[model samples]
Target: MKNIMNKTATVMAVHRERYELLAENHMFYGKLKTADFYNVNERVEFPTVGDEVEILFNETGDSLITKVLPRKSVFMRQTMGLPDQAVAANFDYVFITMSLNRDFHISKLERYLTVAWQSGGTPVIVLTKADLCEDRGRYLEQIYEAAPGVDVFCISSLTGEGIPEMEHFFAEGRTMVMLGSSGVGKSSFVNTLMGKEEMATGGIREADAQGRHTTTHRQCMFLPKEIVLPSGERIMGGGRIIDTPGMRKLIVSEVEEGLKSSFEDIEELAACCKFSDCTHKSEPGCAIRRALEDGTLSEKRWKTYQDMLREEAFSKERKKAMMKKIGKARKEIKAKRG
Candidate 1:
């Protein structure tokens, strides 16, 4: 946007090639009148919020996303029914939102942490509706013991409590996405940031989609300036936030490393086991079992780790076998051509 004046000041929000572009200065969105110029992942065609792009602003108030700057980081997940899909392009932090009530589960949080680490962005635990919990003191103690070294915050959108603490995330240039299940207040959190409700939120169904049951499809929204300071942490510029569709099923596709770290306690237990391949259940010298009996580790956490590892391995094998079939088909076609 050469004539937009605030080239450096404007915030660009993108959703699949000008499907809906909100120029911080323009305040008007236009369709992709000429998107053939850009490639699939190029500007305009696959625009993601928080993406710094060069645009051609026309007099009609409609504009085109011309170029996308090199992103410092990218966040993505294995799309449902699709082997690979880049849901979000660039983001620095992943604010994994969850409530304190029936939706609370440590295993599911571990599952989200899988893709969070793989996405190249740091994951932060954001507990919504902290006001609902009766014994806040006991809950924090429990979560802290379960997941260490992870930054976790509890907030209430209604009371505007714990919101200022989220300010660390709203820094000028850094980008963060609120990922969580339906009815978990991701939208409510976004509304507080935008100072208005910009996303339509739904309630959780009788059953979740895949994993944590948060965000169906990921979308972007440029947050209205959350800060107005002469000097502070925000260097990226203003700030952009992405709100994803509630995920019913958070099955991880390719984040084995994340799974390992998420269950480091279990991994550490296997080190002193009698058998290198010990399954940790009913084994003679399984350290995991020792921890279980000693009350050092929870049975649910241990089982969940095993189940996630199994799923990751199975996903890898299934993809490999499918690739082999495709390779054989290509060979047959080449032979016929010869």
Candidate 2:
């Protein structure tokens, strides 16, 4: 091992108290410094897959991770009582995969789109299992309606359909993160792209169509420099991809900007309301009300928007309360030390 100090590396996988790192084209194991990360007063940002980090080389054992470098893009989600979880970092595209079978849901797609936009990366909807779905056109229409101005690709990993169209996204230096619920064929998709079974694949329950979690951890995989398709075409660009376990509950927080971007049509209507302070319910000349009544916007879509807004507000309040509690606890600790 080179006797280098403060070397940079990309986090490949994060196990509890351990990390898999790729530095200078070599794979190395790493561990965080307790003083700098674990015993800090301020919250420390833990390194996740796709994160660039500074490390101290250790020829003897695992390298020491000193700091987590700033992220250009990050995907995160938080539950109500738990702390925020960073799913992946430094990704260029979020592949929102949803199978066309029982896994397809417009609301779920919309939710994923909101988080994807908020992550500072382009969101591309990838509808998987095209071979299984008979009414592809209907599902495609629903997707187009739900995600306006977003790119959508319908592909079957089994048959290699629509895989060639996604070749451009695999260009060198680009990184894409796969985001979807369990059983949506994310591993299969990765396997297909790799031209081999790089990740394990699982089947969904036949009765409910709900998928089992084949990928239980988040890890970054480097794409092959050249991938030859079964159809005799070659994908000639190398990139990186981070695959995460399926999130059963994707509770979003601090995604106000993402909401506005995802629901631009609804926001536009609200902007045109006659009263700036209009409640949008009983107010006269309310653009939203008029649109709802005139079939311009579907009621289901409007309800989803309202529900997300409420959820966002609730999450904000919860975070504030949690922070206040932590501050109080810190003050008590300081007093004891004094």
Instruction: Provide the lowest-lDDT 10-residue window in model 1.
Output: 228-237
The regions of model 2 sitting more than 4 angstroms off are 1-4
List model 2 lDDT by residue over 54-163, tens digit each: 99988789999989999999999796676798999999999999998877789999999999999999999999999898988888888888889999999998888898
TM per candidate comes to: 0.73, 0.96
Model 2 residue 130 CA deviation in Å: 0.7
The local distance difference test score of model 2 is 0.90
Model 1 shows how many backbone clashes? 22
The reply for model 1, stretches above 4 Å from the true place, is 1-72, 202-217, 226-237, 281-285, 324-338
lDDT of each: 0.67, 0.90
